[model samples]
Target chain A: MNSRLQAWLLALPATFFVVVCLGLPVLSTLATTFGEPAGPFVTYIQFFTSGFRRAVLLRTIEVAVITTAISLVVGFATAWVVARSPGRIKSILIIAAVFPLLTSVVVRSFAWMVILGKNGIINKALLALGILNEPLSMLYTEGSVIVAMVYLFVPLMILTLVGVLEGIPQDLTDAAASLGAPPSAAFRQVVLPMAVPGLIVGAVLVFTGSFTSYATPQLLGGDRQTMMGTFLYQRAMVTFDWVGASTIAAVMVVVTIATVLLMSRLARKLNPVVG
Target chain B: MKTRIHPALIAFSVFTFVFLIGPLIIIIGTAVSDTTFLTFPPQGFSMRWFANIFEVSAFPRTMVTSFTLAVLATTLSLMVGVPAAYALARFRIELPKFLANVFVLPILVPEIVLGFSLLKSVATGVGASIWTSLLIGHALLVLPYCVRVVGASLNSFDFSVEEAAVSLGCPRWKAFFVVVLPNIRAGVIAAFILAFITSINDVSVSIFLTGPGISTLPIQLLAHMEQFFDPTIAAVSVLLMGVTVAVMTVVEWTLGLTFLTK
Candidate 1:
């Protein structure tokens, strides 16, 4: 066989499997929304027209944005520390940062449930400290979901940022400082601009992660705090609203893809070389 | 001249680490609590919850199912992903771009979407069993990781040894097995571990794909938690974390966790 044919042949099996199993299924399911008798966009219309679903969609975006924003700040600080640390400490810190990722999301969310429950640690501690006469209802709320998601995804943000931060020379900031720029001004002018690409990458990951996350919202937020992921699950599995589910799924994919493309474009504009 | 990291930044990072790792520590602590309800800073110590993991039955059964499913899916992903990675790395072909995207399309799409899609198309449309649909979904889930990790490994490898083997008397295919495979063993192993862990821990896809009598460990735990708020779940979670720690230790020893950065 010619080299082209050989390469194509080599790539064929995985490509074929993915197309048949994943690609076709997702596409066909998206197409199912169009098959609705009322109209091609009826499911989407119904979804948007409903106050609850609109809230869910807005809440999903809100959670994702908040999670991404928080993760970026925390991850940047943590990554900066890890990246600048000496070799042994850097390795240890990276391991520490990544250790949570190795465990299941279910386990991690369960931990939050333990911490936030009425009789859980925080309530007990607050009670013991006389901080509150009554336990605050923390679990099964939007705040709880966001907190759990930040814990779940911040490591990803750190992983994405650390290498890029490490590649930046430390002297660049110092040079700006030595040139009579304030330290904060130096960071804003020198370090922050350069870190934009990594920031975008990390932001995109955390955003989409929390955007489509199922387990955390379902476990911690419950029905009271319905996000897109949990909404899709309820529509599909519980009510068997296939059209509604398909619409949600299609919208989610489109939103996720759009976020990625928009962020990549932003990253490219900011850092042409890396892009 | 050495620059100093700000004390405030150091303090903030310390807080972040505690936030990141604190929950797992709390879970571990709760696991050993003697109380019926999940609690931290135990009132007393007991091994009953660990024993209760066995008595729960779903925990042990689904653990086996999850392990078997993860192994099978990782194997399937490797079989499909290795050659694709090789072709992409070595071929210098234009189609590699399109093919690479297709291979990675699963990761780009929300896994919940993929899971629901598979449930609709494979299970309902094609009439495949839920178990088979799950296997297919999970394999697709991990396939991208397999390709990316192994492809990174392949890119760094010197292909000249395989070329030399081909030039000498060995067939091209045989040369790949004898020369290339041995060299990229670490990557393959790394990919396997990563894929296995991902498949096992997966909840988004598995949640949708699972049906009656065919639940993964995570799904089982999720269901168990919905019904009960007890230390048994904590015990089971601690055990699951143990598995993760063991796998990560192996990765640290062999490839170093830095590979995860890739």
Candidate 2:
């Protein structure tokens, strides 16, 4: 076969599979909201206009933003430590970050349930120390969801930031310090600016991961703190509200795509060389 | 002179490490607890919960399903993805960027959305079986990894050897099989392992795709946790972690963990 035909033939199966399995389904889901009898935008209007849904949307964004923010802060520190540490300790730290990633998210979230439940370690410890007479309910709360999400996603942030941080030489920071910039000033002026590309990538990953996450919010948040993921589940699987589910799915796709595009643009604008 | 990392930074890193790995340790600790309930620093030591994993009917059955699904999906993804990777790497294809984007688009979309979409369009609309939906979904999900990993390897590969083999009267296809495939073996294996782990561990996509008499291990575990607050879940989690560690060890040994970073 000619090279062009060979190339097309080689790419055919995967392209066909994706188009049929992924692209078509997603496009159909997006189209479902429009097919509603009332109007094309009816489901979307309900999604945005309804107080409950609006709350869920806002809460999803809130949890995702908080999770991303916390991941970035903690991840930067952890990544810095890992990047700057001697070779042996650095690999160990990298393993520490990568190991959790290998396990299931459901397993990780379940661990949080064990930790944050009413009779969980913290509650039991607090009660033993006479901090509280009664165990505080932590699971199913928004805070618990955020906490677990940060734990789940911080590793990703650390991995992303570690590569970029490792690329940055120690001399630059040392030179900054020698030139009268204090440690914090040196980090802010030198390290942080240079790390913006990694930070943006990490932020986007953590943000999108937490934003679209189903299990963590579902398992920990429960009905009391419904995020878009669980809400979409309930609508589709529980109630069979296809339009409603599709609307939520469509919104999620839009939000995720927007975030990715926005962040990439920001990364390009901030670090022209990397971009 | 090598500058010292600040004390506060070290302290923060320690805390973060603890925070990240603390829960897994707690689960493992709880698994060995002699107590019936889940507890950390666990009560007396016993292996009962580990044994109890077999007693849960769902765990074994769903584990088989998950394993089968993961293997099949990863294989399918590799079969589909490797050639595409080859084409993208070697051939001057029209719309290469668009095709690459299409391959990766599955991952770029939120997994939950993907799950729900498949459930709607495939399961409901097309009336496909749950197994078909899951297989298709998972294969699609892991295809990107195959393309990216294999593509990376193929990029760094020297194509001159393949050209030399073809110039020596070997068919182009045979040249690929003998010349290119063996050299990229490490990348292919790494991609397979990554895709396998991803398929087996996935809950978001599997959640919607699963039905009565069909569920993935993670979904089974989720349902089990919802109904029970015992150490069995912890036991299962620890076992899962063990499998993960073993898999990671294999990756580390064969390809090194650096492949994961790529």
Write model 1 residue lDDT over A117-174, tens digit each, in one string.
9987899999999999999999998899999999999999888889988878988887
Classify candidate 2 by CAPRI docking class: medium
The residue pairs found clashing in candidate 1 are none
Q: Could you tell me the C-alpha RMSD of candidate 1 in Å? A: 1.3
lDDT of 1 by residue, B1-262 (tens): 5867999999999899899888999998999999998888876999899999999889899999999999999999999899999999998654646777888888899999999999899998999998899899999999998998899889989988888998898999899999999988888998899899999999999988888888999999999987988999999998888888888887886578976765
Model 2 misplacement above 4 A = A272-275, B92-95
Worst 10 residues of 2 chain A by lDDT: A266-275
- TM-score on alpha carbons, each prediction: 0.98, 0.98
TM-score of chain A of each: 0.97, 0.96
